[model samples]
Target chain A: DAGITQSPRHKVTETGTPVTLRCHQTENHRYMYWYRQDPGHGLRLIHYSYGVKDTDKGEVSDGYSVSRSKTEDFLLTLESATSSQTSVYFCAISDPGLAGGETQYFGPGTRLLVL
Target chain B: EDQVTQSPEALRLQEGESSSLNCSYTVSGLRGLFWYRQDPGKGPEFLFTLYSAGEEKEKERLKATLTKKESFLHITAPKPEDSATYLCAVGEGGGGNKLTFGTGTQLKVEL
Candidate 1:
Protein backbone atom coordinates (compact mmCIF):
# COMPACT_ATOMS: atom_id res chain seq x y z
CA ASP A 1 0.00 0.00 0.00
CA ALA A 2 2.99 2.27 -0.01
CA GLY A 3 3.11 4.21 -3.23
CA ILE A 4 2.23 1.18 -5.33
CA THR A 5 -1.02 0.95 -7.30
CA GLN A 6 -2.31 -1.88 -9.41
CA SER A 7 -4.79 -1.22 -12.21
CA PRO A 8 -7.99 -3.09 -12.96
CA ARG A 9 -8.47 -4.02 -9.30
CA HIS A 10 -11.15 -6.51 -10.36
CA LYS A 11 -11.54 -8.26 -13.67
CA VAL A 12 -13.51 -11.19 -15.01
CA THR A 13 -12.14 -12.88 -18.10
CA GLU A 14 -12.74 -15.97 -20.14
CA THR A 15 -10.44 -18.85 -20.85
CA GLY A 16 -7.82 -18.47 -23.58
CA THR A 17 -8.15 -14.69 -23.54
CA PRO A 18 -5.17 -12.45 -22.99
CA VAL A 19 -5.14 -10.47 -19.76
CA THR A 20 -2.76 -7.77 -18.66
CA LEU A 21 -2.43 -6.26 -15.22
CA ARG A 22 -0.56 -3.05 -14.56
CA CYS A 23 1.45 -1.97 -11.53
CA HIS A 24 2.45 1.63 -11.08
CA GLN A 25 4.67 2.89 -8.31
CA THR A 26 5.46 6.41 -7.26
CA GLU A 27 8.25 5.36 -4.89
CA ASN A 28 10.64 4.73 -7.83
CA HIS A 29 12.20 1.83 -6.01
CA ARG A 30 14.93 -0.18 -7.69
CA TYR A 31 13.05 -3.46 -7.49
CA MET A 32 9.53 -4.54 -8.39
CA TYR A 33 7.83 -7.90 -8.10
CA TRP A 34 4.64 -9.63 -9.18
CA TYR A 35 3.04 -12.28 -7.04
CA ARG A 36 -0.18 -14.25 -6.98
CA GLN A 37 -2.07 -15.26 -3.82
CA ASP A 38 -4.41 -18.22 -3.81
CA PRO A 39 -6.15 -20.30 -1.19
CA GLY A 40 -3.96 -23.06 0.27
CA HIS A 41 -0.97 -22.07 -1.88
CA GLY A 42 -0.04 -18.88 -0.11
CA LEU A 43 1.71 -16.24 -2.22
CA ARG A 44 3.90 -17.27 -5.14
CA LEU A 45 6.16 -14.96 -7.02
CA ILE A 46 5.52 -14.77 -10.75
CA HIS A 47 8.33 -12.46 -11.83
CA TYR A 48 10.51 -9.59 -10.74
CA SER A 49 12.43 -6.70 -12.22
CA TYR A 50 15.65 -5.36 -10.78
CA GLY A 51 15.60 -2.44 -13.13
CA VAL A 52 13.87 -1.26 -16.27
CA LYS A 53 13.99 -4.09 -18.82
CA ASP A 54 15.89 -6.33 -16.42
CA THR A 55 13.43 -9.00 -15.48
CA ASP A 56 13.56 -12.55 -14.20
CA LYS A 57 11.15 -15.40 -13.59
CA GLY A 58 10.10 -16.52 -10.13
CA GLU A 59 8.62 -19.57 -8.42
CA VAL A 60 5.41 -19.56 -10.48
CA SER A 61 6.48 -18.07 -13.78
CA ASP A 62 4.80 -20.57 -16.05
CA GLY A 63 1.91 -19.14 -18.08
CA TYR A 64 2.86 -15.67 -16.97
CA SER A 65 5.14 -13.04 -18.48
CA VAL A 66 6.28 -9.65 -17.29
CA SER A 67 7.62 -6.47 -18.86
CA ARG A 68 9.05 -3.32 -17.40
CA SER A 69 9.51 -0.48 -19.83
CA LYS A 70 9.84 2.25 -17.22
CA THR A 71 11.11 2.42 -13.70
CA GLU A 72 7.71 3.17 -12.31
CA ASP A 73 5.68 0.63 -14.21
CA PHE A 74 5.70 -3.16 -14.23
CA LEU A 75 3.19 -5.18 -16.19
CA LEU A 76 2.10 -8.80 -15.89
CA THR A 77 0.58 -10.55 -18.88
CA LEU A 78 -1.25 -13.82 -18.96
CA GLU A 79 -0.80 -14.87 -22.57
CA SER A 80 -3.78 -17.20 -22.53
CA ALA A 81 -5.76 -17.04 -19.35
CA THR A 82 -6.85 -20.26 -17.71
CA SER A 83 -9.08 -21.01 -14.76
CA SER A 84 -6.03 -22.10 -12.87
CA GLN A 85 -4.56 -18.64 -13.22
CA THR A 86 -7.45 -16.98 -11.46
CA SER A 87 -6.18 -15.42 -8.24
CA VAL A 88 -5.38 -12.19 -6.47
CA TYR A 89 -2.31 -10.52 -7.92
CA PHE A 90 -0.12 -8.15 -5.96
CA CYS A 91 2.76 -5.88 -6.88
CA ALA A 92 5.57 -4.98 -4.53
CA ILE A 93 8.46 -2.51 -4.49
CA SER A 94 11.75 -2.34 -2.64
CA ASP A 95 15.13 -0.63 -2.69
CA PRO A 96 17.94 -2.29 -0.77
CA GLY A 97 19.97 0.88 -0.86
CA LEU A 98 17.53 2.41 1.58
CA ALA A 99 17.18 1.43 5.19
CA GLY A 100 14.66 -1.36 5.69
CA GLY A 101 14.70 -1.80 1.92
CA GLU A 102 14.85 -5.53 2.41
CA THR A 103 11.20 -5.27 3.34
CA GLN A 104 8.83 -5.18 0.39
CA TYR A 105 5.86 -2.85 0.29
CA PHE A 106 2.83 -4.16 -1.56
CA GLY A 107 0.04 -2.72 -3.64
CA PRO A 108 -3.64 -3.04 -2.84
CA GLY A 109 -3.82 -6.04 -5.19
CA THR A 110 -5.85 -6.98 -8.28
CA ARG A 111 -8.37 -9.79 -8.20
CA LEU A 112 -8.82 -11.73 -11.43
CA LEU A 113 -11.40 -14.37 -12.13
CA VAL A 114 -11.07 -16.64 -15.14
CA LEU A 115 -14.00 -18.69 -16.32
CA GLU B 1 14.26 -25.47 -1.79
CA ASP B 2 13.36 -23.08 0.99
CA GLN B 3 10.15 -24.00 2.75
CA VAL B 4 7.99 -22.55 5.55
CA THR B 5 5.16 -24.08 7.52
CA GLN B 6 2.67 -22.37 9.83
CA SER B 7 0.57 -24.12 12.44
CA PRO B 8 -3.07 -23.89 13.42
CA GLU B 9 -4.51 -22.89 10.07
CA ALA B 10 -7.35 -21.20 11.90
CA LEU B 11 -7.79 -20.05 15.47
CA ARG B 12 -10.63 -18.40 17.38
CA LEU B 13 -10.15 -16.46 20.58
CA GLN B 14 -12.04 -14.19 22.90
CA GLU B 15 -11.06 -10.61 23.42
CA GLY B 16 -8.10 -10.23 25.83
CA GLU B 17 -7.04 -13.78 25.17
CA SER B 18 -3.33 -14.29 24.65
CA SER B 19 -1.92 -16.78 22.20
CA SER B 20 1.05 -17.65 20.01
CA LEU B 21 1.39 -18.50 16.34
CA ASN B 22 4.23 -20.62 15.02
CA CYS B 23 6.22 -20.55 11.79
CA SER B 24 8.88 -23.11 11.05
CA TYR B 25 11.29 -22.94 8.14
CA THR B 26 13.94 -24.94 6.34
CA VAL B 27 16.27 -22.89 4.24
CA SER B 28 19.97 -22.56 3.55
CA GLY B 29 21.77 -19.43 4.79
CA LEU B 30 18.63 -18.07 6.51
CA ARG B 31 19.09 -14.45 5.59
CA GLY B 32 16.02 -13.12 7.39
CA LEU B 33 12.57 -14.00 8.65
CA PHE B 34 9.58 -11.74 8.26
CA TRP B 35 6.14 -11.51 9.80
CA TYR B 36 3.20 -9.79 8.14
CA ARG B 37 -0.42 -9.04 8.98
CA GLN B 38 -3.01 -9.07 6.24
CA ASP B 39 -6.63 -8.10 6.34
CA PRO B 40 -9.18 -9.60 3.98
CA GLY B 41 -9.11 -7.83 0.63
CA LYS B 42 -5.86 -6.01 1.37
CA GLY B 43 -2.18 -6.53 0.77
CA PRO B 44 -0.03 -7.77 3.63
CA GLU B 45 1.58 -5.20 5.89
CA PHE B 46 5.02 -5.83 7.26
CA LEU B 47 5.22 -6.48 10.98
CA PHE B 48 8.67 -7.57 12.09
CA THR B 49 11.96 -8.93 10.83
CA LEU B 50 14.16 -11.25 12.84
CA TYR B 51 17.72 -11.69 11.69
CA SER B 52 19.04 -14.29 14.06
CA ALA B 53 18.10 -16.78 16.70
CA GLY B 54 17.37 -15.35 20.14
CA GLU B 55 16.38 -11.99 18.69
CA GLU B 56 13.00 -10.57 19.58
CA LYS B 57 10.93 -7.60 18.48
CA GLU B 58 7.81 -6.12 19.95
CA LYS B 59 5.05 -3.72 19.09
CA GLU B 60 2.13 -2.59 21.17
CA ARG B 61 0.34 -5.93 21.57
CA LEU B 62 2.43 -8.21 19.38
CA LYS B 63 5.86 -9.67 20.00
CA ALA B 64 7.95 -11.70 17.54
CA THR B 65 10.74 -14.01 18.50
CA LEU B 66 13.13 -16.01 16.38
CA THR B 67 14.92 -19.32 16.83
CA LYS B 68 17.31 -21.46 14.79
CA LYS B 69 14.48 -23.41 13.16
CA GLU B 70 11.37 -21.32 13.69
CA SER B 71 9.81 -18.04 14.77
CA PHE B 72 6.92 -17.23 17.05
CA LEU B 73 4.45 -14.34 17.02
CA HIS B 74 3.11 -13.79 20.49
CA ILE B 75 0.03 -11.74 21.08
CA THR B 76 -0.62 -10.55 24.61
CA ALA B 77 -4.02 -9.37 25.71
CA PRO B 78 -5.28 -9.26 22.13
CA LYS B 79 -8.26 -7.21 21.06
CA PRO B 80 -11.03 -7.87 18.55
CA GLU B 81 -9.30 -5.51 16.11
CA ASP B 82 -6.32 -7.86 16.12
CA SER B 83 -8.20 -10.37 14.00
CA ALA B 84 -6.47 -11.02 10.69
CA THR B 85 -4.33 -13.49 8.81
CA TYR B 86 -0.70 -13.70 9.90
CA LEU B 87 1.85 -14.63 7.28
CA CYS B 88 5.41 -15.82 7.69
CA ALA B 89 8.17 -15.74 5.08
CA VAL B 90 11.87 -16.43 4.92
CA GLY B 91 14.62 -15.04 2.72
CA GLU B 92 17.74 -17.03 2.15
CA GLY B 93 21.17 -15.57 1.64
CA GLY B 94 22.16 -15.13 -2.01
CA GLY B 95 18.57 -15.92 -2.95
CA GLY B 96 18.11 -12.73 -4.93
CA ASN B 97 15.48 -11.24 -2.68
CA LYS B 98 13.06 -14.08 -3.21
CA LEU B 99 11.11 -15.17 -0.16
CA THR B 100 9.40 -18.47 0.58
CA PHE B 101 6.15 -18.00 2.45
CA GLY B 102 3.90 -20.18 4.55
CA THR B 103 0.18 -20.59 3.89
CA GLY B 104 -0.62 -18.37 6.89
CA THR B 105 -2.79 -18.65 9.97
CA GLN B 106 -6.21 -17.07 10.20
CA LEU B 107 -7.11 -15.51 13.53
CA LYS B 108 -10.57 -14.47 14.66
CA VAL B 109 -11.07 -12.54 17.86
CA GLU B 110 -14.47 -11.96 19.41
CA LEU B 111 -15.46 -9.51 22.09
Candidate 2:
Protein backbone atom coordinates (compact mmCIF):
# COMPACT_ATOMS: atom_id res chain seq x y z
CA ASP A 1 0.00 0.00 0.00
CA ALA A 2 2.87 2.27 0.69
CA GLY A 3 6.03 2.03 -1.33
CA ILE A 4 6.57 -1.42 0.17
CA THR A 5 6.65 -4.61 -1.87
CA GLN A 6 6.89 -8.21 -0.72
CA SER A 7 8.37 -10.93 -2.90
CA PRO A 8 6.95 -14.38 -3.58
CA ARG A 9 3.40 -13.14 -3.17
CA HIS A 10 2.33 -16.69 -2.39
CA LYS A 11 4.19 -19.86 -1.55
CA VAL A 12 3.63 -23.39 -0.35
CA THR A 13 6.31 -25.28 1.48
CA GLU A 14 6.67 -28.45 3.45
CA THR A 15 7.54 -28.81 7.09
CA GLY A 16 11.19 -28.41 8.17
CA THR A 17 12.05 -26.51 4.98
CA PRO A 18 13.75 -23.18 5.05
CA VAL A 19 11.95 -20.18 3.62
CA THR A 20 12.77 -16.55 3.23
CA LEU A 21 10.34 -13.71 2.56
CA ARG A 22 11.64 -10.45 1.22
CA CYS A 23 10.23 -6.99 1.89
CA HIS A 24 11.52 -3.96 0.02
CA GLN A 25 10.42 -0.41 0.62
CA THR A 26 11.11 2.49 -1.70
CA GLU A 27 10.09 5.05 0.94
CA ASN A 28 13.42 4.49 2.71
CA HIS A 29 11.85 5.06 6.09
CA ARG A 30 13.86 4.67 9.28
CA TYR A 31 11.88 1.71 10.60
CA MET A 32 10.82 -1.60 9.06
CA TYR A 33 8.78 -4.40 10.60
CA TRP A 34 7.64 -7.93 9.87
CA TYR A 35 4.26 -9.24 10.96
CA ARG A 36 2.19 -12.36 10.52
CA GLN A 37 -1.63 -12.46 10.20
CA ASP A 38 -3.72 -15.44 11.06
CA PRO A 39 -7.46 -16.08 11.21
CA GLY A 40 -8.04 -15.06 14.82
CA HIS A 41 -4.65 -13.78 15.98
CA GLY A 42 -4.66 -10.66 13.82
CA LEU A 43 -1.19 -9.27 13.08
CA ARG A 44 1.64 -10.25 15.40
CA LEU A 45 4.99 -8.53 15.17
CA ILE A 46 7.85 -10.82 14.34
CA HIS A 47 10.90 -8.56 14.06
CA TYR A 48 11.92 -5.02 13.29
CA SER A 49 14.95 -3.09 12.11
CA TYR A 50 15.83 0.42 13.12
CA GLY A 51 18.93 0.69 11.01
CA VAL A 52 21.16 -1.43 8.87
CA LYS A 53 22.16 -4.52 10.86
CA ASP A 54 20.22 -3.18 13.84
CA THR A 55 17.43 -5.64 14.40
CA ASP A 56 15.31 -6.74 17.31
CA LYS A 57 12.69 -9.36 18.11
CA GLY A 58 9.01 -8.55 18.53
CA GLU A 59 5.97 -10.12 20.15
CA VAL A 60 6.15 -13.30 18.11
CA SER A 61 9.78 -13.79 17.23
CA ASP A 62 10.22 -17.43 18.05
CA GLY A 63 11.07 -19.75 15.12
CA TYR A 64 11.92 -16.76 12.99
CA SER A 65 14.82 -14.46 12.26
CA VAL A 66 15.37 -11.21 10.40
CA SER A 67 18.19 -9.30 8.70
CA ARG A 68 18.53 -5.83 7.26
CA SER A 69 21.76 -5.25 5.39
CA LYS A 70 20.39 -2.19 3.59
CA THR A 71 18.02 0.61 4.34
CA GLU A 72 15.50 -0.52 1.74
CA ASP A 73 15.38 -4.26 2.29
CA PHE A 74 14.26 -6.30 5.30
CA LEU A 75 14.11 -10.03 5.14
CA LEU A 76 12.32 -12.58 7.33
CA THR A 77 13.58 -16.12 7.46
CA LEU A 78 11.93 -19.21 8.76
CA GLU A 79 14.73 -21.60 9.72
CA SER A 80 12.47 -24.61 9.68
CA ALA A 81 8.94 -24.06 8.53
CA THR A 82 6.10 -25.57 10.50
CA SER A 83 2.36 -25.77 10.00
CA SER A 84 1.93 -23.30 12.82
CA GLN A 85 3.94 -20.78 10.83
CA THR A 86 1.53 -20.80 7.92
CA SER A 87 0.03 -17.36 7.67
CA VAL A 88 -0.09 -14.14 5.71
CA TYR A 89 3.06 -12.13 6.24
CA PHE A 90 3.15 -8.38 5.90
CA CYS A 91 5.93 -5.80 5.97
CA ALA A 92 5.56 -2.27 7.20
CA ILE A 93 7.57 0.95 7.24
CA SER A 94 7.35 3.94 9.49
CA ASP A 95 9.06 7.18 10.46
CA PRO A 96 8.70 7.94 14.12
CA GLY A 97 8.93 11.68 14.51
CA LEU A 98 9.81 13.74 17.56
CA ALA A 99 6.32 13.28 18.95
CA GLY A 100 7.04 9.58 19.44
CA GLY A 101 4.08 8.50 17.32
CA GLU A 102 3.99 7.04 13.84
CA THR A 103 1.57 5.66 11.28
CA GLN A 104 3.05 2.66 9.51
CA TYR A 105 2.46 1.85 5.86
CA PHE A 106 2.24 -1.78 4.84
CA GLY A 107 3.12 -4.06 1.95
CA PRO A 108 0.73 -6.22 -0.03
CA GLY A 109 1.71 -9.28 2.01
CA THR A 110 2.92 -12.80 1.23
CA ARG A 111 0.71 -15.76 1.93
CA LEU A 112 2.59 -18.88 2.97
CA LEU A 113 1.08 -22.29 3.41
CA VAL A 114 3.03 -24.99 5.18
CA LEU A 115 2.20 -28.56 4.46
CA GLU B 1 1.21 -5.71 29.26
CA ASP B 2 0.08 -3.57 26.37
CA GLN B 3 -2.80 -5.14 24.48
CA VAL B 4 -5.63 -4.34 22.06
CA THR B 5 -9.11 -5.78 21.65
CA GLN B 6 -11.79 -5.11 19.02
CA SER B 7 -15.46 -5.84 19.43
CA PRO B 8 -17.98 -7.51 17.09
CA GLU B 9 -15.49 -9.73 15.27
CA ALA B 10 -17.75 -9.44 12.23
CA LEU B 11 -20.61 -7.22 11.12
CA ARG B 12 -23.27 -7.27 8.44
CA LEU B 13 -25.03 -4.11 7.43
CA GLN B 14 -27.39 -2.90 4.77
CA GLU B 15 -26.52 -0.12 2.44
CA GLY B 16 -26.91 3.31 4.05
CA GLU B 17 -26.74 1.83 7.52
CA SER B 18 -24.65 3.74 10.02
CA SER B 19 -22.67 1.94 12.70
CA SER B 20 -19.64 2.13 14.91
CA LEU B 21 -16.64 -0.15 15.45
CA ASN B 22 -14.88 -0.26 18.77
CA CYS B 23 -11.22 -0.78 19.61
CA SER B 24 -10.30 -1.10 23.27
CA TYR B 25 -6.66 -1.03 24.30
CA THR B 26 -4.23 -0.76 27.19
CA VAL B 27 -0.67 0.41 26.71
CA SER B 28 2.32 1.36 28.78
CA GLY B 29 2.15 4.97 27.67
CA LEU B 30 0.13 5.63 24.59
CA ARG B 31 1.91 7.52 21.88
CA GLY B 32 -0.77 7.18 19.22
CA LEU B 33 -3.68 5.13 17.96
CA PHE B 34 -4.14 4.14 14.32
CA TRP B 35 -7.01 2.90 12.19
CA TYR B 36 -6.60 0.84 9.02
CA ARG B 37 -8.88 -0.66 6.39
CA GLN B 38 -7.94 -3.90 4.69
CA ASP B 39 -9.62 -5.63 1.80
CA PRO B 40 -9.48 -9.35 1.38
CA GLY B 41 -6.19 -10.46 -0.21
CA LYS B 42 -4.56 -7.11 0.35
CA GLY B 43 -2.43 -5.17 2.78
CA PRO B 44 -3.87 -2.72 5.26
CA GLU B 45 -4.53 0.85 4.18
CA PHE B 46 -4.02 3.64 6.65
CA LEU B 47 -7.10 5.56 7.71
CA PHE B 48 -6.47 7.81 10.68
CA THR B 49 -4.13 8.59 13.58
CA LEU B 50 -5.33 9.89 16.91
CA TYR B 51 -2.82 11.26 19.39
CA SER B 52 -4.78 12.33 22.45
CA ALA B 53 -7.99 11.30 24.15
CA GLY B 54 -10.01 14.22 22.85
CA GLU B 55 -8.68 14.06 19.30
CA GLU B 56 -10.82 13.07 16.36
CA LYS B 57 -10.18 12.57 12.64
CA GLU B 58 -12.41 12.21 9.64
CA LYS B 59 -12.42 10.97 6.10
CA GLU B 60 -15.29 11.09 3.59
CA ARG B 61 -17.63 8.57 5.19
CA LEU B 62 -15.63 7.51 8.23
CA LYS B 63 -14.83 9.31 11.46
CA ALA B 64 -12.42 8.16 14.17
CA THR B 65 -12.47 9.28 17.76
CA LEU B 66 -10.13 8.46 20.61
CA THR B 67 -10.58 8.18 24.37
CA LYS B 68 -8.38 7.30 27.32
CA LYS B 69 -9.07 3.61 27.07
CA GLU B 70 -10.42 3.05 23.55
CA SER B 71 -11.13 4.41 20.09
CA PHE B 72 -14.15 4.32 17.83
CA LEU B 73 -14.55 4.26 14.06
CA HIS B 74 -17.92 5.55 12.89
CA ILE B 75 -19.25 4.80 9.49
CA THR B 76 -22.19 6.80 8.19
CA ALA B 77 -24.49 5.71 5.40
CA PRO B 78 -21.94 3.17 4.29
CA LYS B 79 -22.00 1.82 0.79
CA PRO B 80 -21.20 -1.69 -0.30
CA GLU B 81 -17.78 -0.42 -1.29
CA ASP B 82 -17.15 0.40 2.34
CA SER B 83 -17.12 -3.27 3.23
CA ALA B 84 -13.75 -4.37 4.55
CA THR B 85 -11.91 -5.38 7.68
CA TYR B 86 -11.02 -2.49 9.95
CA LEU B 87 -7.94 -2.83 12.13
CA CYS B 88 -6.76 -0.83 15.09
CA ALA B 89 -3.25 -0.59 16.49
CA VAL B 90 -1.43 1.25 19.24
CA GLY B 91 1.96 2.90 19.18
CA GLU B 92 4.00 2.88 22.33
CA GLY B 93 7.15 4.83 23.02
CA GLY B 94 10.02 2.49 22.35
CA GLY B 95 13.32 2.38 20.50
CA GLY B 96 12.09 0.31 17.56
CA ASN B 97 8.71 2.11 17.31
CA LYS B 98 6.63 -1.01 16.89
CA LEU B 99 2.83 -1.18 16.92
CA THR B 100 0.56 -3.64 18.70
CA PHE B 101 -2.55 -4.61 16.74
CA GLY B 102 -6.03 -5.88 17.45
CA THR B 103 -7.61 -8.83 15.71
CA GLY B 104 -9.82 -6.49 13.61
CA THR B 105 -13.53 -6.28 12.83
CA GLN B 106 -14.76 -7.54 9.51
CA LEU B 107 -17.59 -5.48 7.94
CA LYS B 108 -19.89 -6.53 5.16
CA VAL B 109 -22.25 -4.07 3.53
CA GLU B 110 -24.88 -5.34 1.18
CA LEU B 111 -27.11 -3.37 -1.08
Give candidate 1 regions above 4 Å deviation.
Answer: none
Report the Cα interface RMSD of each model, rounded to 1 decimal: 0.9, 1.5
The native-contact fractions of the candidates, in order shown, are 0.60, 0.90
DockQ of 2: 0.79
| Model 1 interface CAPRI class | medium
- What lDDT tens digits, residue by residue, belong to model 1 across residues B1-111? 899999989999999999999999999888789999999999999999898999999999999999999999999999999999999999877745878899999999999
lDDT of 2 by residue, B1-111 (tens): 789999889999999999999999999888789999999999999999999998999999999999999999999999999999999999887667778999999999999
Q: Identify the CAPRI category of the predicted complex in candidate 2.
A: medium
The Cα RMSD across the true interface for model 1 is 0.9
lDDT of the candidates, in the order given: 0.93, 0.93
Candidate DockQ scores, in order: 0.77, 0.79
Highest TM-score: give the candidate number. 1
Per-model TM-score on C-alpha atoms? 0.98, 0.97
Q: Candidate 2 residues A11-60, lDDT tens each?
A: 99999999999999986788899999998899999999988999999999
